[model samples]
Target: MSEQKFTVGSSITESYRFLADHMPHFFRLIYGPLILWVMVMVGEQILLIEHDIHINSVYFLNVITAAFAIVWYRQFLLGSDYASYRLLIKKGFSNSPLSFKRVSRALLRILVVSLVLLVPTLLLSFSMMVYFHGQGVPLSEAFIQELAFKSTLIIMLVFSPILIRLSLYAAGFALGRTSLRMQDIWKRTRGYTVTLWWVTLRAFLPLSIYSYILTLFLDVMSEKLSINYIVSTIIIETLAGFLTFMILAIVVAANAEAFRILIGVRDGDVPHRDGLKKNTAMPPQTNRRQTSKDIPQKTR
Candidate 1:
């Protein structure tokens, strides 16, 4: 690997372009899993409201939807048109069942990495709880809660780079590069530590802000705006549903695009049944494909 470069702007652009091109297929094949995800989210909220119970069902369901999203992303980028259109006829809309095994393994790895990113937050929260208890403060003490929240946010920001690099496992697995070693990951991703960090922060910081605003908006709607809770719930959950699907879709596309630009795919990546392959191997410096105005979306 030579000196590497990462682009936040073009990758995001390509990601949305990719999503737009596949929007029809997205609605068809993805609606099932997406509905399941939203149902779980709404159910979790209902349980909390009625019984004061909480379940992390949404997170687990995320793995399922993400698995399919990764499959579609890799399929669009690496699959052949014959294999794609042929199956698009037979199977409603998906052309990537061949990658089921790889998607499963990839998602498992991704799940682990995602969980790892929460380690600092979890440990800090736990430690704070213990410290607060020792200080005769309740677990729900407002001061401790605020302190822990701020500290966890700072820690996540600090660890954002690590999250970006580890996210390669998602791309690699989608491309059937499952047995990636850390040195390979580290080497292939050379000179991109800061760039990846910035990309991750830039791509997702708006989401964080939007969520915070939405939370406040809901509060205001119920309190000052005199909105009914059910109406507010419908509005919020509808927006949340769109956010869930959009974010999951973009994440896989961005991961696939970033991997192609930064690390690249070899000649025989994940060959399609029609004998097609992603032939371009981007140099680590990223002068070739990343800066190109147009990336061919279909194999001729």
Candidate 2:
């Protein structure tokens, strides 16, 4: 079967369709990790409530959960149907989907890119600070702050394409590609950066709006209700966590879809009509008797 060529929009739509078709299975696959993550988060919240610690501690926990969630999502994308909690925990620490070597290389690449993009901005900011200080202008002035913010935004816009191009590394790592070098990913993603950007925006923009609305609603409820602030905090955190997971799932699915399409093109794999084969191997046979029972016997 010739591989069906898909445009960026079609590829994204197909990815959503694939997720919808396999929603139940995906939920089942992710439930274990999700539950564990929720538990950890709730526990952390409870501890925070008791100790009255700064919210920074919760941020740390969120980082941990996000890493684990990424690993689990990657495993699912790679067709792992069953992942034990122990394995998930271990993989989270080990960054299983991305090997240590690949991660190290990626980090190095990121650092180089960051320095290249950011060093000039940093230098400019430093020079501005020194000049202002010498001029008896405080660095805390609003003008200085706005300038810093604008500079950062400009840098981000400039580097956005490079970042998006490298974004597929997670999917590549998950798929266990032997050659996921930065240059290789860049070459493969050539001409598709804008498409990938569009797909990502389509996936996340609505979710962001939805989350903002939900947050406002939660805030209003907390204000109107007689419930304890802790209870409100927990509720807000739970909902936020759920939304975060949903976003992560969508991102993983979309990126996986893009990766599949790119790899298919690269390898000249015919896109079969079967719609991105989830299972490369043949399915198990059904019982002959059950199959026969479904067919009406002809009476002479």
Candidate 3:
């Protein structure tokens, strides 16, 4: 297969098309995990409401759900459809173990890249603090605190590009790669930083707003109906979970599409070794069994 290039707009379009076509399969693949997540969330909300105790265990459950979601993305990229619930569970643990090992590895790579880019800002901030303290200025003063806060914002803005560039590690990891290298991702994204950022915004912003509005509307309706707070909360959380999963699927799909394009995989092209069909040109058919009389002859 030849490597294909993509623009930001094209990639966004492709991601939407992929989602539209495979939404049913994608939902089937994720329904179990989504239900589990909703249960966890509802439990947490109930705990907070009834006992006034925040259950930190939900975070662990969230991580598990995230791992499963990553596996789904991996399967999507590999051109797989929804498997049975049992098979999906088995694959999550066996085929793509979304253990701390893989998650931490990817996080560490991103953290290292982020810290390297942030070193200069860190040093400058430290130097400023030291100089201010030497001049009898308290670091806790409002002026110095405001300066630090603004400086932190500036640093975030400056390094945002590097952060965005490395965002594909999730997709890379999902592709069943043994290890992810920051340099490799950087190289792959050489000329597409702006495009990737734009695509991310295009994909994320609307969905986020829609989710928020939907939740708010549901809350208002529940209030008007005089429903129990816990019941309303559970309903809202369930719908919110579905929306969150959908957003996640779309984002992962977009990133996977971009990754595929970067690696020269065309849309609908599966690798031969995967025992999947390839998009190949068909050979012209010839009537090899035709007799000589079947052929048209020219007059002498």
Candidate 4:
């Protein structure tokens, strides 16, 4: 069957329709890890206690999280049957058991990406230690510097999941299904990503403003000797983040996928319909008529 073509710059409603129409199996491409991460975060927070060992807890958590990511990645890739979009969507998004082999492969990619992101921080820490040792800094001072260095590592570990997920989505869109080169895909998508980022930031502006207002209210309540004001503020932040993510997910994903479709059409991967085709020149046979010239002459 010929592919259906769509024009760019269509309405927001149309964008929604397109996503609804093409509901690929890999739709969980963005949300699976997200749900896992939230659960992990909640569990970790709940388990924090004075009696328990907190030493290197964040580091261990990072390792475990990286493992989870890798496992999922492998499953996603394996289900794609070596990166075919159709197959990937079909198997990866199913309710059946995730392939153990895919999980292994995903873990490897996660480890590689994680290491690439971590190396710089690791080097900085080593350099700091060597420099401080050379200066004969006291043990306590040296320990404090090391703690700060490790804290930086922890921060990177926290944000690494977000970066990895975005990169995977971009890379998948670029290379996985359509067979485009990474560089070419990046060129097509870089601008879209920038635009999405700007729109996303704008979308969060309201939340930020509301957060400030809520903070002020909390402060007032605190001054007035109200209890659990912080709890209310925390709830607001949680709800705001969830709502912001949900709203932006729809807008950004729709627009991004729309652009992808446009790219595909431009490459002749999707064909325009007869009425919608643009070129004006007609074929010689287009206006041909049934003629009776020879028969009429004979009759005459």
Candidate 5:
């Protein structure tokens, strides 16, 4: 494995490497379906706004996104490896080739897990909404019932993808290289989750700062003689989006590396080879041990 460690995980260079090394076709894997969903949603919204039309297409579209999320999550988990990371970076700059089977598996898992997680959250949201409405209006009313149901369902839909990601991380710890059961994965990851969150917060802070500054600048600039504010806003938005995407990729890559390290431990690769028993794939740790010993001991 490369000794180079990514502190932010999805820094621009690491993100580039992640895609180039692991799955070159990752863009197509994500954006193809995403674009379709966006187009459908945008078109529906446009029609409603432009022509006083009402279409129930939003429900179907949400369903599709949830379905796609399920399939992608499972496949990614099953097929993930260090090789995937390496290949993502070394391959073509313009094209990334990822496996379809892997993609399909990931997507399928996402859908299943999303549903599992969404149910409880949805129920809670619905119950709260209904309780609030009933305090002021009749619970038996048709509109109240309908509002409660629809709001609950949409809340579930919004949460589905987040749930799927959680499930995949859980599943990966259970069956991926680490081979730890779900409970163990949970215990281990729970220890690391705070650290990961901190890192993510740091990664996002830069963008947030940039956005705030840009917005402030825009507010001031807008006050000046007429500016092509729309173009500047678009450019800023694009830059922000790209930066965010790169950061996300880095984060994903770092998690993948962390998982690999945990998997190594699970495979009986001890901190030092001497601590290990019998023949194994793990390399000897003579130099590592020597290096450890040369360090001045702290007076405890």
Candidate 6:
């Protein structure tokens, strides 16, 4: 078994190089669907502004992100050799290689992992929201809601590293590399929890710093220019959208890279030699501790 240590710096660097090498095609792959998604987002923002509410509605945007992420993950894992419009998400939904069932299964697994970690925080946040809204102060309603939303985001950011431990399932499901069961994920990723956390921190640290600085700069610009408040705010809200998309794309690739490395080891409770297949028979088992057959063997 290749019990090699996870290299955080190398993972980030390799993912960056990979994206740099393939960015044009990558953008084409995501452009159409992403544009429509942005349109809807802008429409929602306009509606919110009309209602005198300032907070951005992000739940739908998150779903759109996840949809594109599946495409990116599968592309990286399956390689471009597979002849499918897997890149064209709009076409891919029905006409591409991924079956409706396969996508649904992946979505279900993602939801399960997300809800497990999110439920407790959500419950507490919900209680706080209910308590505040019941106070019935009209002006305070939007303020309280936005406060709760930001608080939830902060809590999520704090727990982000912990979320990375279960990332194998995220990248894995995109290619059906592992079973959907949480126990399977836990056993598959055991002993490497701390390593995954480090990867998350390194991957996101730059984005966090960049975000803070960009907000400061933009706020200064908004004040100095004396632009329309809604326009400036919308521009600010979506200013880092592309950078964020790129960073998250790199993170998804990094997760896939980590999965390819760690999934090979014949670790605790990972009974099979090759990875778990989506609908086919399991690969023949092995007792040699490790064999390089499931994923494309790479030269290090």
* Tens digits of per-residue lDDT for model 6, 156-203: 667764576556666655564444555666676778777777776777
lDDT of 4: 0.43
lDDT of 1 by residue, 60-140 (tens): 776656556655656645653422333532432233454566557646866787677677777887787778789897665
**Model 4 misplaced regions, further than 4 Å:** 1-46, 49-90, 93-97, 132-181, 187-244, 247-300
The reply for model 1, stretches above 4 Å from the true place, is 1-5, 49-58, 79-140, 206-235, 268-300
Error of 1 at 202 (Å): 3.0
Candidate lDDT values, in order: 0.62, 0.61, 0.65, 0.43, 0.46, 0.62
Candidate 2 lands at a TM-score of: 0.68
Counting clashing residue pairs in each candidate, in order, gives: 0, 3, 1, 6, 32, 0
The window of 10 residues in a row where model 6 has the poorest summed lDDT is 270-279
Expressed as tens digits, the lDDT of each residue in 1-300 for candidate 3 is: 135667777777767766675666667767777777767777777899888989775666667556655755555565553224454445542366457775576578667876875686777678888887889987777877676776677776777667775557666555555455767778767888778878888887789899999999998999999998778877997888788777777776677677776743434333221221111232223222222122121122
Score residue 18 of candidate 1 by CA lDDT: 67
Query: What TM-score against the true fold does each predicted structure earn?
Result: 0.64, 0.68, 0.67, 0.43, 0.43, 0.65
As for candidate 4, its clashing pairs are: 70-106, 70-107, 74-102, 74-106, 75-102, 80-88
Ranking by TM-score: 2, 3, 6, 1, 5, 4
Candidates 1 and 2 compared by TM-score, better number: 2
Per-residue lDDT over 237-260 for candidate 2, one digit per residue giving the tens place of the 0 to 100 score: 667766766666676667666766
lDDT of 6: 0.62
How close to the true structure is residue 129 of candidate 1, measured as C-alpha lDDT?
A: 76
Instruction: Give the C-alpha miss distance for residue 25 in model 4, angstroms.
Output: 16
Q: What local lDDT score does residue 206 receive in model 2, on the 0 to 100 scale?
A: 77
Error of 5 at 211 (Å): 3.3
Sequence-dependent TM-score of model 6:
0.65
Error of 3 at 259 (Å): 0.5
